[model samples]
Target: MSIQVGDRVPEVTLKRLREGLETIDTYTLFDGRKVVLFAVPGAFTPTCSARHLPGYVEHFNDFRSRGIEVFCMAVNDPFVMQAWAKTQSVPDGLQMLSDGNGEFTRALGLEMDASSSGMGIRSRRFALYVEDGIVRASFIEEPGQFEVSSAEYVLEHLPG
Candidate 1:
């Protein structure tokens, strides 16, 4: 089943480009912290670049002020994730996570077959509000939909 509110995130490794390529586990990343984790099918896509990603970027401080960390994930490699970060002028506060092999995405039951679009296996658009490794809320979008998983929606729901 796909993850839900109150579910513990699956233990899996994801890549991020910091000073260099750094490997991080979902277990560690969400441990003892309030995190807003958002996922997209792929990075650099139209909707993703135009609104999804930028929404998070623009709301970095909104999350931070609430003591939450923001994470953006995609089914792309670390290199592409890093490049998109730069392309979007993402700051240091928002982390770009890469589910390179889609293992993490599959583990969370959020993988989508995008082979017809030449995107191969990808992540469904979703966001999770996690605290101390347990989900506080989960906003998963329907296929080809962008109605629920935006930063504005997450912000509206975060504990004040």
Candidate 2:
């Protein structure tokens, strides 16, 4: 089933690139914190790289100012994600998480197969406001849609 607002995030270990190799789990990463986790189709796609990811990057400070940690996730390897993060100049505070095998995406029921587009398994565009590993809010884009998952939308939904 698709993850919902009140559901606990599934436990999973994901690789994250740091000075050296590092690992993190869903619960540990988000437990006891309000996190804004947004997923895109792939790491370096056109609209994703130019608009989706950049929107979050541009608003990283704003999100943090509201006490929400921002994370960008995609079904690409950590190495590719690291390169993309550098290319986009992603600040240290804005995390780039690699769901390389799509395990996390699939566990959340957000997996999308884009083999027709030669992208393989990817994630549908969505954003979630998670607190202590439970989803507080979820914004899912309709097929071929983008507005709802934008950073501005997530910002507007932040609990006052």
Candidate 3:
């Protein structure tokens, strides 16, 4: 089953390119924090680039003002994620994370087989609002859709 509102985030190491390639575990990123983690099927793809990531980039402060740290995650390598962040002009505080092997995605039961598109295993488009290591809300998009997981939607539906 997919991760639910009350599920604890799984422990897995995700990569991010900051000063260097860094491996951060789920516990460190989510424990005792309010976070909005949005996943894309692939970085730099059409909707993800034009709408998804940009939406977060545009509203990074809106989330932060509410005391939530935002993170963008994809199945691509850290290098691609870093490049996408640069190209998108992502804010410094909006973290770009890499689940290169799809371990984290699979652990959440959100992995999709995109082999037909030559992307292989990838994350489904979804967003989660997590507080102190437990999911407070989850917005999982239907296949080939983008409405529910958008930054605007997640922000509107965040639990009080």
Candidate No. with top TM-score: 3
Q: Candidate 1 — worst ten consecutive residues by lDDT sum?
A: 151-160
Off by over 4 Å in 3: none
Local distance difference test, candidate 1: 0.93
The ten-residue window of minimal lDDT in model 2 covers 151-160
Model 1 segments more than 4 A misplaced: none
TM-score quality measure for candidate 3: 0.99
TM-score order of candidates, top first: 3, 1, 2
Q: How displaced is residue 8 in candidate 1, in Å?
A: 0.8
| Inter-residue clash pairs, candidate 3 | none
> Please, what is the whole-model Cα lDDT of each candidate in the order they appear?
0.93, 0.90, 0.97
Please give the distance, in angstroms, between residue 66's alpha carbon in candidate 1 and its true position after superposition.
0.5
| Model 1: lDDT of residue 147 | 74
Residue-level lDDT tens digits of model 2 in 1-160:
7899899999998888898667889889999998999999988888899899999989999999888999999998999989999999999988889898889999999988799999899999999999889998999887778998999888987765
For residue 145, model 2's alpha carbon misses the true position, in angstroms, by 1.2
- Per candidate, the number of residue pairs that clash is 0, 0, 0
lDDT against true structure, model 2? 0.90
How much is 43 displaced in model 1, in angstroms? Answer: 0.7
For residue 25, model 2's alpha carbon misses the true position, in angstroms, by 1.0
